[model samples]
Target: MYGRILKVYPGSLAEELELVPGDKLLEINGTRLRDIIDVSFAFADEEIEMLVEHEDGQQEVYEFDKDYDEELGVE
Candidate 1:
């Protein structure tokens, strides 16, 4: 599950999630993400796992657990 961060809205949902522009999404709950549709569907769950790649070539994994309908605060 991988997609590049195309854009981020100022003071929007994505900003609160720390999803910065130029970051590359690598996976969701250990599952590979193919596109925007996959990311939308995968984030529907209460718990999610993600892999993010920074422009410096550093990769980090994150786990987020929240209310099912909680907005991801993403762009």
Candidate 2:
């Protein structure tokens, strides 16, 4: 999925993770992300590993643990 982030909400988990608008969300725990719904479902787990591809073509991995119903805090 071309799961590009369009925006990052203030004080959100995404922001906490330093995710920015235009950052492409590549995967979650090695599973490719296809869309927002996919993101939501993947985030259901308390333990998450996000693969983010930046606009500069650099890839980064972010892992964190949160509640099952935790919000991404994005807009």
Candidate 3:
């Protein structure tokens, strides 16, 4: 199971990672996501390891080192 990305805000971390709508978010920091609530909790960390499945069916992992208060800007 995965969370589908709907939008990536410009000038945000999602955009910086090149994520787009239709991308499937699989996990954050190795924890599987079951709902939006999980996403919220998982995103609180300064270090993130995200696994995403692109529209092309290719899966990739993205790592980010950010401010503890930074947002990813995806909906």
Candidate 4:
């Protein structure tokens, strides 16, 4: 299962990663995502490995080391 991105906020990590609406979030930190709750838990970590499938069907992995409070900025 994948969580679809509806929006990527300006000045957010998601924006920096070039993620956009319609992109599908596949996994975080090597764990496949099933729902928003999983996403929330995954976001608690400072280090993240995210796999995203673009609207065009291209898959990309984005890794980041961030402050614990920093937000991914996607809804």
Candidate 4 is scored at a TM of 0.93
Best by lDDT: 3
Please list the C-alpha lDDT of all candidates, in the order they appear: 0.78, 0.86, 0.93, 0.91
User: Mind giving the per-residue lDDT tens digits that candidate 1 earns over 8-69?
Assistant: 77775457667888888888787788888888888888887878898889998878686777
Leading candidate by TM-score: 3
lDDT score at residue 13, model 1, on the 0-100 scale: 48
Error of 4 at 2 (Å): 0.9
Q: Which whole-number lDDT from 0 to 100 does residue 29 have in model 3?
A: 98
**Of candidates 4 and 1, the better by TM-score:** 4
Candidate 4 runs further than 4 Å off = none
Model 4: which residue pairs collide?
none
What lDDT would candidate 2 get against the real structure? 0.86
Error of 4 at 3 (Å): 0.8
1-75, model 2: which lDDT tens digit per residue?
758788898888999999998898889877898788888888898999989899999999999999878898765
**lDDT over C-alpha atoms for residue 8 of model 3:** 92
Quote model 3's TM-score: 0.95
lDDT of 1: 0.78
How many collisions between residues are there in candidate 1?
6
